[model samples]
Each structure stands twice: as C-alpha cells, then as structure tokens.
Target: MIGGCAPIDAGGSGGGGSDGGARGDGGGSTGVNPLDNPKGTERGLGVIKSAKDLAEAIKIIEKVPTKGRGPKTGYDRDEFGYAWADNAEEIPLAHNGCDTRNDILARDGEKLKYRSGSNCVLVSMTLDDPYTSKTIEWTKQDASEVQIDHVMPLSYDWQMGASRWSRSKRVQIANDPLNLMPVDGSANSSKGDSGPATWLPPAKGIRCSYVVRFAQVALKYDLPVTAPDKDAMLTQCR
Candidate 1:
C-alpha cells in the first residue's frame, strides 16, 4: 500500500475495464523502452526487441565496475534523506512544492485523480505496473496495491559503494527519478535490496529493459554492484 489510492471520479480519467491501461499479457507492456528513457522519467518498461538497443544496453552495463558487497555497517533509510523528500540536491523534481513520492505518482500513473484543491496529492489512479505487467486500478483507500520502487534500492546502494558517499550525494541518488519507478507493491517488496542476480520484473520480456535501467542508475552514481549482479545485468541484454 502507498499514499493516496482511493476510488474517486473527480473528473479524473476512469479506469479502463479490469486491465486499466496495462496489457496484462505476461510479456511487458508496449510502453517506453529503456534506451529511450535513460533518465528513468519515462512511463513503463517496454520489451527491448531491437538488436541495436540490446547492443547499447550491453555497453551501458559494461561501464559499471563490479565489486563484492560491503557490510551494511551504518545503512539507514534516513541516511538517504527523510523518505520522499523534495529537498535533495542535484535531482529532478526536487523543491517543486511536492514531495518525490507525489512527483512520481504523477509521472507514471494515468487516469489520475488529485485531492480536492491540491495539484500534488493524488487521490486515485490506474497504474500499468511494469514489474508484474498488471493493470492496477488503485484508490486512495487501496494505496498499498502500488508503490514507488527504487530501481537501485537504497539498501543495495549501501552494500554496493554508497556507504562511503557524502550525505548530499546520497540524498540525490535516493530521490533521483533515474532510480525510481512506480510498480506493484508486492513485486517491489520481493526485490527488497536484491539486484539483477536475484531479482527482476515478473514480466519476463521486461528483463533486458529492467537491467538496463538498473545499470543506468549504477553508472550515474559511479556505484558498483556485486560481480554476480553485474554478470546477471549484462546477460539480461541478451
């Protein structure tokens, strides 16, 4: 469950049947491709079907160095910044008078409803959850059905190389749109700090795109994943 999921028309786009806008066909949606959405500000994870794109994806993954995971000696959620802060430096959508959570909700969701007189707090929406390839018709009362997931999870960041990063830099990565997605809460929960070696979208066709997105975040922060994770990430592009 997440914040602001409730069934209210409020002139918002209505959910499209049981499918909402999601295809729910087991493969990934025909949403934006990872190569086209390097900033991770795009809508959904589409299947990467082109050899050219896959080749580019490989190059991106290859740029990230591999290292053994370090001890999470002092990893705290707060270390990244208070959850969903809009004050993080050098990140998009920060200080926009709305929190990071709401900014993402607006970015990915369709058929959206906003709270009365509030442009930021979404009251309801239809989400094409890329992780599970499911169409989620969510209301404010049923918020947990969807969540904003960190592609390069904060905890994973700690174990990878972020334990040594400065506080402001840590905050930037935490709230960066390049590392975020809105997806099925259950799928997100399953990922819990694991990387490509152990976790990926349930939508098999999205794997290459997912791993590519993961690599984007890693390289952006100059962070390294475990060797196995890097190998797994490279494999997904094939």
Candidate 2:
C-alpha cells in the first residue's frame, strides 16, 4: 500500500481540503517527515511545525557554507547524466529497473496506475504538490502539470562549484531524492535555477521544510548556497 494520504478521485474538484493538501501528512507511512527522511526515501515533504523543530532546521541552514555564484560556462544537464537516468549510481532507488522520475512518482504519488505490462511506467496518479499546496490529478498525457523540481538547481550547482566536480558526482546530485520534489509544473518553472532568496514555495507552511531540504541537499553534496540564499533559508525557519 502507498504510504501517506488516500487516493483522491481524479474527477473530483480542485481543492481537497487542507488535510488533503500535501504537508505534514499525506500518504500512509511516508507522511511528510523531511527531518527524519534524510535519504529521501519518504513520500511527502513533511511539515516542521513546532518551534523546536524550526530552530533545529535553522541550525542546519546556518551551517551551509556561503559563496558567490560563478559564471554558467561549460555547464549542461547532460553533465549530470541522462535525465532521470535509472543507472545513476551511489544513490537511493538506482538500478531498480526504473528511472529516477518514475521511482519518485511511485514513492510519493497515490493510487498509481502504471502503463500496461510495465510497473515502471507511471501513466497517472494524484500528487498533493507541496510547492503550491494543490492536489493535482496528473496523467502522462499532461506531463507538464507535474514536474520534478531539483531542490538545488543544476545551474545553481554549477555556479556554486559543481562545474569543477567529476561527471559522476554531478549525476548523483541530479538523481538524488533528497534533492528532488514532484511539484506543480508552473511553480517549478518559475523556480528555475533560483535559490531560496529568489523563490520559495507558495504554500507558507512548507517554506521551512523546503529550505531545510535545500540545506540537506547542499550539505550532502558539499555545495554551498549564495549568502542571500542562506539568509533567506534561515528566515523561513525563524
């Protein structure tokens, strides 16, 4: 069974009530536990509601080394690996006979329907998108309605010194679940390559969790955020 929230009817209206929205709890066992799910195996981007939790999140954010962004020369998505490559090594859900994209969809999506004769191909599912606080009924036909956001954008990584890393390291950062989120398509587009300073989740409640996830990815990869980005991240928790 899927972890977090129950599957909502696809044909139903847009809003699924606050509880239905993706936050602290959604799918069953995966119910939005960002602090605990450091490896990104959990389903939703769980909320950090308590003051103590918020302070702890801020502590993580403060430790992220800060640096100025570098030029975008010699940076390309292919440097990471084939997009959503199933073969990317040294990360969760790799070599599972499924690409990173579909793996995450199955991990977080509810009432999943796979393509005929293929458990790996997700044709449709419901997403309580954390970025916009919306429940999206997504189908393969309307693929852009939902997008997998890189918590740390690849370009930002490049600017922050990923350009100097070996190609294999880039691939791990790209496919790492701690760095990815299936969020509303438009929100993802608007967030292109921006750090926390420039863009944040529209859902006010998830900002702390979002920044914490950002910090987690940065720390894991040994990448640093811009000074302003780090400051903005701390603000979210405060």
TM-score of each: 0.88, 0.88
Candidate 1 stretches greater than 4 Å from native = 1-30
Clashes of 1: 9
Cα error of candidate 1 at position 209, Å: 0.6
Which candidate achieves the best lDDT against the true structure? 2
Root-mean-square deviation of each candidate, in angstroms? Answer: 5.6, 5.8
Q: Rate the local accuracy (lDDT) of all candidates.
A: 0.78, 0.80
lDDT of 1: 0.78
Displacement of the residue 145 alpha carbon in candidate 2, Å: 0.6
Model 1: weakest 10-residue lDDT segment is 10-19
Off by over 4 Å in 2: 1-31
Model 2 scores worst on lDDT over the 10 consecutive residues at 10-19
